[model samples]
Target: MIDLKACPLWLYRLLPFLRWWPNVTAHTFKADSVAALTGALIVLPQAVAFATIAGLPPEYGLYAAMVPAVVAALWGSSWHLVSGPTTAISIVVFAAISPLAEPGSPQFVTLVLTLTFLAGAIQLAMGLARLGGLVNFISHTVIIGFTAGAAILIAASQIKNFFGLDMPRGAHFHEVLIHFGSHLTDIQPWVATVGAATLAAGILARRYLPKLPYMIVAMVVGSVTAAVLNARLGQEATGILTVGALAASFPPLSMPDFSLTAIKQTIFPATIIAVLALTEAVAIARSVATRSDQRIDSNQEFVGQGLSNLAGSFFSGYASSGSFNRSGVNYASGAKTPLAAAMSALFLLLIVLLVAPLAAYLPVPSMAAILFIVAWSLIDFHHIGEIVKRHKRERVVLALTFVGTLVDLEKGIFLGILVSLLFYLYRTSQPSIRELVPDPAELRNPRRKFVAKTPDTATCPQMPILRVEGSIFFGAVEHVQRHFRNVDEADPDKKNLLITARAIGFIDLAGAEMLAKESNRRRKLGGNLYLVGVQPDFCEMLRRSGQVDTVGEDQIFRHKGEALQAIYPRLDNEICRRCTARIFDECHVALPDGTPRAVADQREAEAALARLHAQGATAS
Candidate 1:
C-alpha cells in the first residue's frame, strides 16, 4: 500500500482511486460482489428502457452501463454511487438532438457522441477549477420539486409503450397527455395487460419477498404472461411487443461529427446536459453518503463523471449520470466500497454478453412497468409534505421547480434556484432594528439586560437606545437609515442616540458612512450618537472607512455603562433640571454640567416640600 499523504500531486491526480484502493479487503470484496450482482440485475432493464427513451438502440444503453460505469466508479468519490444512463438525461438528449437528426440514425448517434464529448469537457473543466461548491446553490427544495417533476415525466414517457399507443415521438408533457386522450381507442389490450401484470408483480414482490429483487420478478412475470397470452390468443390477436435482441459485444470505438453545423446545434444543449448531469450525480452521491455515514468529495465526483462521459463518447455511450436506483440498491445490498460499483459494471458487461439474445423475450411494457416503479420511488413525499406544511417560502420554490421540470426538464431547477435566491436576498436586506430600553429592575444587576421598550418602563427623555439585529451591508444600509430617520421624526428631543451594536453582525463601508452622517446630524441638533458593545470588526470598518473620527472615538464603548458614563455629562443641563425621569444613577446626582446642588440644599428642599404637604392636609 502506498502512502497517499506523501504521494506527489501529479500521481494522485492521475489515479484518484488510490485514495480508496487500500479499503478493499477480503470481507469487503465478497460484500461488494454481492452488491454488484444485485445492481447489475436492476440496471439491465433500466439501461434498455433509458436507451429506448433516448431514441438509441438497446445495445447502446448496455454500452453506457459498462465502460462509463466502471470509469465513474473507479474515479468518483462516493462509495456506492453507480453512474450510467438515466431517465432525465436520456429524455434531454432525445429532445435536444431529435430536431436536428432522425432518432437512432447514424447522424443522430454521431451528434449525440459529439454532444457528450462537449458536455464532458465542460464538466471536467469545472471540476478541475474546483467549482463543485456551485452545487450548494441548488437548494433542497429545488431538488425535491425537480425530482417530483422528473418522476412524472418518467411515467409520462413510458405511457405510450405501456399502453401500446402510437403517439408521435418527442412530444411535450401536455402534448403526450392530449395525444394519449385522443388515442384512447387505439390502446392495445395485451400490452396494457403485460404492463399491469409487471407492475402488480413488482409491488407484490417488494411487499412480501423484500429480499428478492422486485424488478426481476416483475420482468419475469410480465414476460411469462405475455408469452402465455400470445400462445393462447395467437400472435396477431395479442399486440405485445418485445425489446429486440441487444448486440453482445464490448463498447466499440465511435466517432463524433465535428462539423460546424453539428457543433452549433449541439453546443448549447451540451452545456445544459453538463450542468444537469453534474447536479444529478453529486446529489445522488451525497444522498447515499448520508445513509452510509460517508463523506463525499463533490469536486472529485465531478471529475469522475466528466472523465466517464469523455471516455464514453469514444466508446459508444451517450450522456450518463449517477443512477439513484442502482446506487440505492448497491448500498442496500451491502456495498462496502467503490469497488462494488466498478464490479457492477463488469457484471453488467458479462450479463449482456451471456444474455443479449434472451432480451428478445423481454416485453417492452414490462420494461415500462419497471420504470413506473422507479419513477414512483424518486419522489420524496415525506419531505415534500413537511415543506408544504411548515415552510411557505420553500413550498413556493418546490412548486415552481416541480412545475418547471414538468414543462421544461433542464431549466426548471434553474428557475427554482433563482426564486430561492431572490427570497434569501430579500430577507437578508431587511434586518430587524428594534428600540431597546434598560430594564429598570435589572439596572442594578451585574449583567445589564435590555428589553423591548414599553410605555410602562421609565426611560431617559434625552437619549434613546436602539438594537440592530442583523448585518448592515449595502443592501441593508437604506433600511437602517430609514429606521434612524423614523426615530428622529418620532422624538426630536431624543437627540442623544445610543445604539446597542452587539447584535449588528456586520457593517460595511456604506453602513459606516451612514452612521457617521447620522452622528453629524444629531450633533447639529445639540446632541450626538454613541455606540455601546460595538463589535471589533465593525469598529475596524468604521476606522478603515475614516468615519470613526467623524463620529468621535470617545462615542464608541465596550459596554453600555461606559457609554452612559460618557454621554451623561453631555446632556442638556436645563433638560435634566426639569426632568423627573431619573432613569440612570447619574441623573439623580447632578445636572449635565456637573452643577452639584449640595446635600444640604436637597434636605432643605425636602423640608419645604413636607411643610407644603402638611398645610394642604390641615386645609382639607
Candidate 2:
C-alpha cells in the first residue's frame, strides 16, 4: 500500500488537473487547438442529434457536451476520455424520462438534471469507498453486446427520418421496422431524396475525402437538396421538412429538482444510468489506453464522471457520458494529453457563440444520417468472432445481451452479467479428480507421471492413490464424494485410498466436511483415508472448521515417504505377510506398528507381485 502522506507533494501529484497543467506548452497547445477545433465542429451536429434522441431541447445536448466535459477532464484520470452526450445513454434517458412528462417540457428537463445529480452522487460515493472493483462484475462481452444492440436501435429510431417513413415515437426495433415496412407506400419522395443525399455524401466523403469532417459534408449536401426541393416546389407541395429554429445562446444556468417525490421516481433510473455511464467511460478509457499505452485509474474515472454529471446538473445539462467516436477520434487525432478534452469544451463554447444560428438550417434527415454512421462504428466484429469461437459459454451471454438491449436497454446489461456468472459457477462446481496409478518404469525414482489409463496391479497389496485438482467448495461437495466412492468401491483388495493433495487449489467449509465424513465412512469399511501434501491454508481451514480433529492429524502427511511410512503399519498384517511387492522405500523399514518386513517367505510373496507389476507398468 502506498502512503500518500509520506511524499510532501503527493496530493498535488495524484490530482489529474495538476498533472496536465505542466503539459500546456506551445507544441501541446497547437496540437490541442487543432483537435479542439475539430471536436467542436463534430460535436455541434452530434449534440443536436443526440438531444433529439434523448427527447430533450436541442440545446440541452450541446450544454451537456460543454461544461461536463471540461469538469470530467480536469477531475478524472484518463488523458483522452472526452465525456459527452452518448448514443446509448441518450436512448436510455429518453426511454426513462420521456414517459413521465412532455419530451422537452420544463418539468422534464428539471427531472433529468436532478437525475444527473443523484447519479453523480452515487458514483462519487462508490469511488471514494474504493468500490471501483465492482465494475469487473460487468463483463466486457456484455458491454459489446449491449452497444451492438443499441446501435441497431439507433438505426431503427432514425428509419423515420432516414426514408421519410412515419415511425411511432419510441417504437421497439421490430415495431419500427414493421411500421416502416407497412407504411412503405406512404414514403415522401422529397424527404427520402434529402435523407438519401445526406447518406451518400457522408459515405462518399468518409471514403474518399480524408481531410474534411463527414458530418459537415453530409449536413451541407442534405440541406442544399432540401433547399432546392423547397424553393422549386413550395414547402406545402413538396413537404421538404426542416428543423425550424434553435436558440444560439450559451448554456444557461439551470436548477435540479429536489422534491422527495421527484427524487423517489428518478433515483432508480439514475442508478441504472450511473452504472452504464461508468462502464462506458471506463471501457472507452481502457480501450484508448491500449492504443496509446497509457495507464487509467478506474477509481479516478468514477470520480471524474461523477463530478462531470454533478456540474452538468447545475449547468442546464442532462445525464451524459463518454462517446466512443469522439474519444477514438481524439486519440487518432494526436491528442497529447487530457487537456485536449478540456479544450474541446472551451472551443465548443466559442463555436456555439459564432455559428449556433447555422443549426436552424441543418435538416433532421442530415442529423439522422450522421447518427447512422455513429451507430455503424460501435460493432466490434473481430472481437465478436473471437469470443464466439474461443468460448462457447460466453456466446449465450453475448447473444442474450445483444437481443435484450433492443427489448429493454436499461435491464439488458444486468441480465447478461447475471447469466455470465451463472455459467462460471456451473463450470467450477466439479473439480478434476483422476485415479492415479504409479508407472512401473519410475519405480526407482518415484517422480514420474501417473498413468490413469493403466490398470492397477496392486503392487503394494492394499493402498490406492488418486490426484485431486481444483478448489473444494460448497457446490463441489457431491462430485468429490463420488470420486472417493469410485476409488474405494473399485476392488476389495484395494481398501485404503491415499489422496495426493498437492494439486488441490483451495478448500472451504463444505470441502472440509466432505473429507471428514469420507474418512469416517472408509473407517467403517475397514479402510482408511489419508491426505498427502495438503496446503497449509487448506489445513488451517480444516482446523478452524474442526474437521482436522475428525479426520485426525496423524492421517495427514507432508510428503509421500512420510505418508507411506505412516500408513504401512495400518495395512492388514495378513495381506502384508503374504505380499510379494514391497514397492516403497519405507516398506523396507519397520512399519509404524513395529512390524518388520516379512522374512524369507514374506519377501518371496511380495517380490513375486512386484515383478508382475514391473512387467505390466502398474501399482495400486
Candidate 3:
C-alpha cells in the first residue's frame, strides 16, 4: 500500500481525491451508494430537460451528466457538489451557438464542443494562476438578474413546442411573444392539453409529494395523456410530436473543431461561459461546504470544473457547471464524500440505459411544460422583491441586467457587472467625513466620547476635530483634499485641523501626498494639522511614500488624549482666551500661554451680575 502520510503536497493537489480516500470506510461507502442512487434518479429528467434547453439531442444531456460529473467530483474540493448541465449554462450555450448554426444541427453541436473546449482551457489557466477570486467582482445581483432573464428566454423558446405553433426556431424573446400573439388561433388543442396536464402534475407533485422526483411524475402523466388523445383521435388529427428513443449506448467519443475560424468564432463566447461557469461552480461548492462544515478551496474547484469541461468536450458533452439542485440533494441524502458524485454518474448511465427506450413516448409538449417549471424555479422571487423594495443600487443593477439579458444574453451580465463596479467606485471615492465634538455627557467620564457635531453644539474657534471613515486611496484623494480645504475656507479661524484617523482603513501614496500637502498648507497659514490614533498601515504608507517627515513625526500621535495634550498648547493664546467652548479638559483650566483663566472667569461672572442688576432697574 502507498504511504499516504509520506505523500508530497503536489500529489495531493494533483489527485485531490487522495485527501479523502483514507477516510472512506465501508459504512461511508454504503451511505455514498444510497446518496448516489438518489442523485441519479433526480438528475435523469433534469439532464433531458437541460439538453432540450441547450438545443441539443436528448442523449447529449445525459452524456453531460456522466463524465463531467465524475471528473468534477474526483478532482474538485467539495464532497457533495455535483457538476452537470444546469439551466443557466444550458441556456447560455444555446444562446451563444444558435446564431452561428442551426439548432440541433451537427454544425451547432460542433461549435458548442469548440466553445466548451475553449472555456475549459481558460478556466484551467485561471485556476493555475490562482485568480479564483475574480468571481467575487461579479456581484450576486448580476447573477440573479441574469438567471431570471434566462429563465424567461427558456420559457419563450418552448412556446412553439408547447402550443404547436409554427414559430421560427431561435427567435429572440420579443419576437416569440409577437408571433404567439399573432398566431393565437393556430394553437393545437391536443398539444396544449398535454402541456397543461404535465404542468399541473409537476406543480402538485412538488407541493404535496415533496419526497418524489416531480419531473418524472409529470413526464409520466403527460405521456399517458398524449397517448390517450392520440389513440382516441388518430395521430394525424391530434398532431402531437414525441422526443423519440434516445440512444442507449455509452457516450460516444467526439472531437472539438480546432480550426482558426472556429476558435475565433467561439473565443469570446467561451470567455463569457468560462467566467460564468466558474462563478456558478465555486458558489455551489462553497454553499454545500457551508452545510457540511467543510473548508472549500475555490482555486481547486476551478481546476476541477475546467478539467471536467475538457473531459466533456472529448466525451460528447457541452459546457457544464455545478447543479445546486443535485448538489443539495446529494448532501440531503447523506453523501459522505466526492465518491457519491462520481458514483451518481455511473448510476445515471445504468438508469439511462434502462429507460432510454421509454423516451419515445415522451411528448415534446410535455418536455416543454417541464422546462417551463424549471424556468420558473430559476427565478428567486423573494430575493428579487427584497432587492427591488429595499436596495436602490442593487435594484438598478438588477433592472439593467434583466433588460440587457432579454436583449442580448451574452453581454447583459457584463453590463450588469460594469454598472455595479461603477456604483461601488462612486461610493468608495467619497469616504465619510464628519466634524466631531466632545459629548457633554461623556466629558466627565475618563474615556471622553466624541459625537458628530451639531449646529447647537459649541466647537473651538481655532481647532476642529474631524473623523475620516474609510480607506484613503487614489480615487478618494481629491475628495479628502476638498474636505481639508473646506475646513479653513468655510471658517478662517479654524486653521488648526485635527483628524481622528482610527476609522481610516488604508492610505495609498496619493493619500499620503495629499496629507503632507495639507500639513504644509496649514503651517503656512500660521497653524498646523495633527493626526490622532493613526493605524500602523496609515503610518507605513506615509513612511513608504516619503511623506512621514513632510507630515512631521511630532504631528502624529498614538492616542487621542496624548494628541490633545500636545496640540492644545500650540493654538493662538488670543483665540483660546476668547473661546467659550471648553471642549477639552486642558481648555477648561488655563490659556495656551500658561496664564491662569481664574481672573477672567471672575470678571465675566461680575459682568453678568451687573448686566442683570441694570435690567432689573430698567424694569422698575
Candidate 4:
C-alpha cells in the first residue's frame, strides 16, 4: 500500500478526505453512523420544505441532500458542516429563477440546473485563485438583515397554501400581503384548520418534546388531521391538497442546458449565488470549527462547495450550501469526522426510499406551516436587538439591508455590503489625531508616560505632540494634511509638530509622500516635523518611497524621552525666555541656547505680573 504520509501537498488538497481517512477506526465509525442517522432524520422534512421553497419538486430536495451532502463532506475542510438545501439559498433560487420561468415547470428546472452549474464553476475558479477571504467583505449585520428578510419572504410565499387563498405564484412580498388582505373572504376553513393544527403541533413539539424532529411530527399531525377532515366532510367540501407521492429512487444523472441563451441568462445570478453560497458555507464551517476545535481551510471549503454543486447539477440537484441547522445537529449529535456527513447522505437515501410513498398523505398546508416554523427560526432576534441597541452604523446597515431585501431579494445583500463598506471607508479616512502631554503623575518615571491633552493642560507653545491612531493611506491623506495645516494656521508659534507613531498601523505611498511634503512645509515655517516610536513597516515604507531624507531620518526617535531630549535643544530660546509652561525637565535647568533658566524664571514672573496689570487696565 502507498504510504499516505509521503503524499504530496497537492494530492492531499485534491482529495481532502484522504487526510481524515486514517482517523476512521471502529469507535469513530460507530459514532459517525449514529450522528449520520440523526442528521438524516432531521433533514427529511427540511429537505422537502426547502425544495418546495425553491419551486422545485419535493424529490429534488432529497436528491440535493444525497449527492451534494456526500461530495461536500468528502472534499470540504470542516468535519461537521453538513451541506444541503437551506432556507436562504432556496428563497434566493426561487426569487431569481421564478421570474425567468414558471415555478415548478420543466423550463424552470432547466434554468435552475444551468444556474447551479455556472455558480459551481465560479466557486471553483475562486477557490483555485485562493480568494477565500473575499467573504470577509460581507459583514455579519448584512447576513442577519438578509436572512431576516428572506425569512419574512418565506412566510409570505406560503400564505396562499396556509390560508387556502388563490394567489399568483412568485409574487413580491408586498404583493403577497395585498393579495392575502384582499382574499381574506376566500379563505377555506378546512385548509386553514389543518395548517393551524400543524403549526400548533410543530410549536408544541419543538417546545415540549425537544428531542424529536418537530417538522416530521407536524407533518404527520397535519396529514392525519387532513385525512380525518376529508373522510368526515367528503373531499369536495374541504379544499385541502396533498403534496402527492415522491419518486423513490437514487439520484439520476442529468445535464444542464449549455445553450448560449441559457448561459447568458444564468451567468449573473450564478455569480450572486456563488458568492452567497461561499459566504454561507465558510461562515458555517468556521462557526462549527470553533466548537469542534478544528482548523478550517476556507479555500478547501470553497472547492468542496463548488464541486458539490458541480456534482449536484449532474445528479438532478439544484444549488446547495452548508445548512446551519443540519450542521449544528450533526455536531450536537456527536459526529466524529467528515464521514458522518457523508454517511448522512446514504442514511437519507434509505429513509427517503422508505418514506417516499407516505408523502402522498402529506398535506400542502402542513408543508406551509413547517416552512413558517423554519422561517421563524431563521430570524436572529437577539442579535438584531443587540445591533439596534449598541451601534448606530450597524443599525443603519441592518435597516437598509432588511428594507432593500423586501424590495428586491437578489440586490439587497449587495446594497447592504456597499453601504457598510462606505461607512468603513468613512471611518478609516479620518484617523484619530489627538494631542498628548506628558503625564504629570508619571513625571519622574523613566518611561515618560503620556495622557491626552485636556483643557487645563499646558503645552509647549512652539511644539505640539500628537498621536495618530490609525492607518495613513491614500484615502486619509487629505485629512492628515488638514490637521498638519491647522496646527500652524491656528497658532503660527506652534510651527513644530511631533507625532507618536507607535499607534500607526500602516502607511502607504501617498501617506509617505504627504509626510515628506509636511516635513518640508514645517521647515519652511522655521520648525520641523518629528516622529517617535516609528514602526519598522512605516520606516521601510519611508525608505522605499525615497522620503526618508526629506522627513529627516534623525527626526525619527526610538523613545519618547529620547525624542523630547533631542527636540528640547532645537526650540526657540527667545520664546522660551518668557514661557512659564516649563513642561519639560530640560526647561528647569537651561534654555535651548544653554543659558541658565534662573534668568528666564525671573523674566517669566515679571511677565506674569505685567499680564495681570494689563488685564486690570483693560477692565478699567
Listed per candidate, the RMSD to the true structure in angstroms reads 3.8, 5.6, 2.7, 2.7
How does residue 411 of candidate 4 score in lDDT?
Answer: 91
Q: What TM-score do all the candidates reach, one by one?
A: 0.87, 0.84, 0.96, 0.96
Candidate 4 lDDT, 504-605, residue by residue in tens: 999999999999999999999999999999999999999999999999989999899999889999999988887889787777789998888987777778
TM-score of 3: 0.96
Tens-digit lDDT track of model 1 for 474-542: 899899888887876788888888899999999989989999999999889888889999988999999
Q: What ranges in model 1 sit over 4 Å off?
A: 1-3, 291-293, 439-441, 451-460, 500-507, 532-540, 551-553, 557-620
- Give the better candidate number (2 or 4) by lDDT: 4
Candidates 2 and 3: which is better by lDDT? 3
Q: 1 or 2, which is superior by lDDT?
A: 1
Whole-model lDDT, model 4: 0.93
Report lDDT (Cα) of residue 558, candidate 1. Answer: 90
> 1-620, model 3: which lDDT tens digit per residue?
89776789999989989999888999999999999999999999999999999999999999999999999999999999999999998998999999889989999999999999999999999999999888888899999999999999999999999999998866899999999999999999999999999999999999999988999999999999999999999889999999999999898999999999999999998999999999999998888888899998989989999999999999999999999999999999999999999999999999999999999999999999999999999999999999999999999999999999999999988999999999999889999999998888777656667899999998889988999999899999999999999989999998999999999998999999999999999999999999998999889999999999999999999888788778888999878876788888877777887776896677667988999999999999
Backbone clashes in candidate 2 total 6
Q: In model 1, what is the error at residue 497, expressed in angstroms? A: 3.7
Show model 2 residue runs off by greater than 4 Å. Answer: 1-38, 244-246, 385-391, 435-469, 491-506, 526-536, 551-620
Better of 2 and 4 by TM-score: 4
lDDT of 2 by residue, 1-620 (tens): 64433544666535657765766789988887787777877888789888888878888999999999998888888878899998888878887787687778898888898899998998888878777778877888998898898888888878787677766666777888788878989988887788888989999999999688787899899889888888899878766667657666777888998999999988988998999999999988998999888888888889889989999999988888887878888888888888899899988888787877777777777777777887887788988999899988889999999988889877887788889888877867877887665565665554534556355454565877878888889988998889888765766777788899998988999999999999998888898889999999989999999999889899999887677767877888777666556666555554435666545456666888899989788654
